[model samples]
Target: MAQRSRVRCGHGRLVALAVMAGSLVMTGAPGASAKGAAGVRPPGDGDTPMCRLTAGPFQRQVEKDLGLPQDGEQSEQDCAAIRKLQNTYGISPADGYAGLVSHRAAVVDWATRHKATLTGCAGRSRRLVCVDQTHQLLWVQQDRKIVFGPVPARTGMPGHRTRNGSHRIYRRVEKFWSSLYDAAMPFSQFFDRGQALHASYRPIFEDPGSHGCVNLRYEDARRLWSMLHVGDGVTVWGTREGA
Candidate 1:
């Protein structure tokens, strides 16, 4: 959930509801972990068996990305490899299912590794925060050199889609609480209206997306907060998949 006014506010009511719904759906699933953010369970929660090759929607892409047998089918090897990617990127459930979040995570990681050739954001002469909604990633660059990220990010979903354009950070709060949504928006930095780049307690790879914000991992957001100033330029481009 997100805040209603300027200055300080929480994440978002819709976001909290989405997270709650996701948690409830997985509450009793096998290998669920209750210690995840907001009581949502992670995949490798406990003594879960290995090679739970549940067929995910993005099975083929994940298989191809991991250099597995590209048959678009699940297997023990696919499960293990996909789960490793999920764990490395902090995707919840780590269940070895190549769902949308998992697929996006893999794609972002690939983009990060090859960011030297990626294009979109301009202003190489000055500090810029680049948000690529198409790939669901963000990074900082100055004088044509990357200073931070190419990190995984989650942007607004279909309806509350994040606007693409040039904006500047206008406000910041280390620990913002949204009374409207009753959730914490840690390291909130407002760049456009109520939309900011902030840390999400929920995994950033979760579905339904943020409420017109650029959601980042806690560590990523903290690092970004330290690197970006109040007036740093932010340029967002591309279209979010479902938006």
Candidate 2:
């Protein structure tokens, strides 16, 4: 049996069933019941909800989210526009979402407030890692161009605020268990004394952040670890200004 979705969305709130805050979980792509042009599942082939706005993934998600009639055809050009929105918002291309047309509009509004500025990283562009604390974003740049990401980040809490200054990656560890906090810090790139850029599973999006570390998602940490090396320059700046 094919499932149908009724999205009661207003003012950016989606009152839908079985949707995670940052992901969409479905047994099959939404509208999986309907077959596409070549009788295929338009966008993705996974059971996961990380939708990338490309030819296959974007179209598939639209079909499911919009319940588009069978035999819908989406051009790569149209998919490219979605990709632009994802990039502009610092959203991962693989972020899963339904009803992309509306989501795209929502992201624009959200990004206007959340996107961090990078111009403060002056004179430190040589193999640099810039952490925008205000927006919880991190990036690796070379020659004034982003090489890796302005990906999501989870920083330290009120008491143990992530240090705000410039430093170098002093160490690298594949698997580190923190004796002080009794937590696991994987793919750690230590810059400050005990603080690091690592992968954490401690509900980073919620309150009370790490003990001064810059925490990233598992995959983001891995990508950073692979791209950065020991002795790379790191700059941490930008306060939340008002509230």
The candidate maximizing TM-score is 1
User: Which window of 10 residues has the lowest lDDT sum in candidate 2?
Assistant: 4-13
**Which tens-of-lDDT digit does each residue in 49-144 have in candidate 2?**
233332333354344333343234443333444444444444443332323322433333443344454456643648999887776667777777
Cα lDDT tens digits, model 1, 1-243, are 343344322456665667756743442243322112312223454665344544666777877767788777666677678878978886665667677777887887677678797789885338899999998889998887888888988888777788899998888888777665666788888888878898987766666677788999999999999988888889999988742
Residue 221 miss distance in model 2 (angstroms): 0.1
* TM-score for each candidate, following the candidate numbering: 0.79, 0.53
lDDT for position 218 in model 2: 86
- Superposed Cα deviation of residue 201, candidate 2 (Å): 1.3
TM-score result, candidate 2: 0.53
Residue-pair clashes per prediction, in order, are: 10, 6
Model 1 earns a TM-score of 0.79
Candidate 2, 179: how far from true, in Å?
A: 1.1
